[model samples]
Target: MQIRLGGLETSEVAALLAEHVEDMRRYSPPESVHTLDLDRLRTPDLTFWSLWQEDVVLGCAALRELDPTHGELKSMRTSHAHRRRRVAAALLDHVVAEARRRGYARLSLETGSPAEFAPARTMYAAYGFTPCDAFGPYVADDFSMFMTLDLADQPAR
Candidate 1:
């Protein structure tokens, strides 16, 4: 799959992000849903990427710079039809590499704590992201699960 830097203007990418927001809302309260909308994803500090094979978008993810040494993962989603095919993994690998390249010492994320998000939690764990307390603007919430990875020793791809 070829990972493009930005494709939010395309209908396919927009729909995928909308579906991601909808899915997040189904499992978490409105206030707990941290999924960024298209406009938010376009902000200056955040870089959005979509993984595509030929013309079809398989998944998408974003990396938001919180500061010089920190970053946050956002809007990670694999299209329903492409689930379980490592679409998220590919996007994740790209995001992590980008973060490391940008000199970020830490990368963190906040996902749902519901069982529906277990697969995501497991995947993050497999990538060496351990449970952590809230970071950035997030506060402690039962509906949220926080995980962080230290990138100091992470080998570059």
Candidate 2:
């Protein structure tokens, strides 16, 4: 699969993000869903990317800069047909590599604590992200889970 930057204007990417947002709504309560819609994702602080093969998109992910030393993972979604094919893994690897390249000492994320998000939690854990208290503008919520990875502590791969 090939990963490229910025497909926000494309119909396929828009549909994928729409599906992702709708899936979030289906699992988490409205107040607890923290997904960034397409418009919000277009902000300068965030860089969106899509993994594609030829003309078809397999998945997408975003890396958002929180500050010079820290970054946040956002809008990670693997298309329904691409699930379990390592699309999320590849996207995450891209995000982490990009964060390190940008000189970020750490990367973090916020996700739901519900069963619907268990696979995501497991994926993050496999990438060395540990559960942590809230960060950025986020607050402690029983329905939310926060995780972070200390890039500085990671051995070069």
Candidate 1, residue 110: how far the Cα is off, in Å: 0.4
Summarize candidate 1's per-residue lDDT along 1-157 as a digit string, tens digits.
8999999999999999989988999999999999989999999999999999999999999999999999999999999999999899899999999999899999999999999999999999999899999999999899999999999966664
Q: How many pairs of residues collide in model 1?
A: 0
Clashing pairs in 1: none
Poorest 10 consecutive residues by lDDT, candidate 2:
148-157
Instruction: Identify the runs in model 1 with alpha carbons over 4 angstroms from their true place.
Output: none
- lDDT for model 2, on a 0 to 1 scale? 0.93
Q: Candidate 2 on 89-149: residue-level lDDT in tens?
A: 9999999999999999999999989898999999999899999999998988878999999
Report the error of model 2 at residue 98, Å. Answer: 0.6
The whole-model C-alpha lDDT of candidate 1 against the native structure comes to 0.94
Compute the lDDT of residue 106 as modeled in candidate 2.
94
